[model samples]
Target: MAEQKQTVSTDDGLILAPADEKQNAVASELEGSGISSPAEYEDLPDPDIGKTDAERAALDKALLWKIDLWLIPWLSLLYLLSFLDRTNIGNAKVANLEKSIGMVGRDYNNALTIFFISYAGAEPLTNILLKHWSPRYFFTGIIILWGIIMTLMGTIENQAGLLACRWFLGLAEAGLFPGVNYYLSCWYRRQELGFRAALFFSAAAMAGSFGGLLAAAISKMDGIGGYEGWRWIFILEGLATVFVGCFCYWMVFDFPDTARFLTADEKLRAMRRLRADNQTRATEEKISRRYVFQAVKDWKTWVYAVQYMGVLCPLYSFSLFLPTILVGMGYKGNRAQLMSVPPYAAAAAMTIFIGWFADRTKWRGYSNMAVSLMGCVGFAMLLGSSTPGVQYVGTFLGAMGIYPCVPNTLTWASNNVEGSLKRGVMVGIVVGWGNMNGVVSSNIYMPQDKPRYLTGHGIVFAYMFTCLFGGTMVMHFMLKRENRLRKSGQRDHWIEGKNEQEIRDLGDVRPDFIYTT
Candidate 1:
């Protein structure tokens, strides 16, 4: 059908007569899409831009709930195993690697530091490597690899053996977090991405909960012949990871269009729908060094990297020391391990609740800032509390705060960019670089710091607060920038398919896509 010319009033009140009707021709061409005035098109299907103002507002709310079910359990499960497998050593420290492996003063700390160093160094590179590999196969292979290494960790005859295993494990598992973040962006609308990120991230909380149980149970295996229970922790948990990773390899969906589960129409709608949500050329793969260079060139890449590194310092440190902290609370090794569960359970609940709230409100920065403050307050209370009950409360609050911010911030930056190349490359750079904080955090809490944990807690609180302030500032700035673009009498700028893929697919017609704050 030939297109008919129509005059539409811009958001700024300027009347736009599409100089060429072919422009946004895709919008006009789509059936049931209602190319008429925004008000008349109340039945349109795009989730990002609903028929009318009221409808668009409503769909934004629905997107939040739509994504919640899938994001929560999947991420939580993955992280639980990853976190447990990574830090079960602290529990093992109490179990007797100190004796069996001849771990002397500071040897354990060095072992952890090795994990973080390799973790940090390899993170940035994983983001890049994921682009060339199918995320399903890549994560699957690596996860299985780490699981095997972790199982081997159970047999360490010396600290050097333990150290060698950790370094390799670090290298193997570096890509999952960033890959998950980048993958989520493919499905949800921008307003809904933060909380989805939060939900996925809360697995850290479970690692604490289930991890403690696993440790307590394994510690009992002390002489089930000759091998210590700590050895069991690594073996059982590593085996679990191998299974889960393999399961994901067999079942994980890549994209809506390619998803074996979705119907043809569903794929079309999913693709078209997201195009409306993000006015960027983000469809399909186009990997190249030029694209990688372009991603590196963006200022937000550095900003995101900095933000991630800052929070991770506190997070990794806290994960490594929870057992010690509980021990400091006066519980025996077994009981302290059990007690670690509650705080993380609380964190899991908070992460889901906060993520839902962020999606419901269509506000990313507010959700993250609030969570960061929660971390700060939680950390503060933890530092001051000598009472066991009060310390548990403080730990709960801190977990709540730290679990969600990085995911939200990472999504926020990713949503701002157009194109799969920029998003993938930049997400990798920022995510990989940000994780470098694990290196800083791993060493911060020395065994000598014990009870008060003054130096470690103090520095962690300081860094988190900085991220809170910095993330909030950047969020608002982006908000203002988006508002300016939206009101610039550029209606075409916001339309679907005018973005990166459209520019690439149809032509270089990058409608005035605006970045959110």
Candidate 2:
């Protein structure tokens, strides 16, 4: 006799059957709704009800492409601007920002540290409120507000003024990174998210390169319009950001359920595909204390948070201090800015490729570990040699190592977590805490440590190694073990007598919800 496949029926209209069985179940449910034939519902025919596998696959591909075109490019642009504005302070520093403003003795680092402190505090609250506020309006308002603040930064005369601007800039800019992560999770499935998220995140690397080139060009404008080159960096970039933010009000979209770009049938198909991808977990749009508690109590949340911390420390330090490092390596002012471009360009390419590869292999944790080793080697090269050429090469390797790990880890966290509110909260927790490492990054590469910054390189290397052998490794094995227990039916007892709502309330802890390794 053939083995039987176990199935569970639910009162919430979600059928917990295997993939093939679930398709048939969806069709049956559609037919039962009294609109079996297309003629009966001509205005809004069911797209998936009677489709063949090939037809469905084509539709899926087309829908995904449409979504990519609509969401990725604009989001990437926004994040690029966000990153450019955030880190151009590095470029300004090399252009004598501290000297012009009378900043001395760790004031620069304090400015950097203050931004991240405000950033970490505001991140979680912004994520929780994102769904409640319209993404389009919310994104537009924050972008414009930050742009105004950054533009005002150009006029500041002292460390006090710069610190105040940096604080509010952090508050205004905190929403975009985590907000985009949560936003993309709602559109893409577990398997498809890695590449899409990477595509969006690769903008940061691109921003690093672009900011270098742009700064090199804009620096020539020193004393033009009665402002120094450093001030123009903030003023011009800030104005452009405001322009983009204004345009975003017209271009940005809300969730799929209300997306005006998709037709009614396409929207239905999008929801259905995500439903299947999620193993029938209904997308929870509303927030409640229950989901918040579930997110905070989950062990995986803290593990991913630690993993993210390991990545962000080096990543932030490199972006914030790359130009200065290049200058330290014997490059002149404009040459230092120009040299910052190539490493970021290389990192951007590797980041996109690894994101695609991670999705294909479904080996997110391993991918993170691998790239982290590359970063280790890069930092080691920096510490081992004093030659400018070798150190330049090390910058390339370091960029490649740290940049790609970000999207992979983010996708891993988003993939395993179920439901909107829980995932949002988890992302907030992970990203918020991870950003706190910027404090460590800011302080490590002090002025006195310049010529070689031994402490900075060693500390970054240690953090990258931790990403490889510490949090990421442990989380990978622990998740694998959990999957094994679930496969052995060890978790079935929790759902044995529970109703649909009870089991649903279990969230990712439910037996049917298998984790992605």
By TM-score, who's the top model here? 2
**CA deviation > 4 Å runs, candidate 1:** 1-76, 279-283, 478-482, 489-511
lDDT tens per residue, model 1, 1-517:
2222344332211123344753453444343232323432233335443366555445544543544454446655776787788888888887777888788888888898888778767766675576567666777778889999998998879888999999998888777777777777776656657777777777777777888888888789888868888888888898889888878775566655576655554455556555555323234556657667667776667776667766778778778888887777788778888888887888778877877776666566777777888899988987887787887788888887887776777877776776666676777777767667776677777878777677878888988888655756675676566545444544343444355334443211133344555
Tens-digit lDDT string for candidate 2 (1-517): 2122334333221224444565555664433331112232343345676766567667878998999999999999999999999999999998889999999999999999999999988888777778888788889999999999999999999999999999999999999999999889888878789999999999999999999999988888999989999999999999999999989988998888789999887887777656655523233456678778888899999999999999999999999999988888999899999999999999999999999998887888888888888998999999999999999999999999999988889899998888888898899989999899988988999899988888899999998897544888999899889876665567677877788668766767876676767
Clashes of each: 9, 0
Measured on C-alpha atoms, candidate 2 has an lDDT of 0.84
TM-score of each: 0.83, 0.92
Candidate 1 clash figure, as a count:
9
User: What's model 1's lDDT at 488?
Assistant: 52
Ten contiguous residues with the weakest lDDT in model 1: 8-17
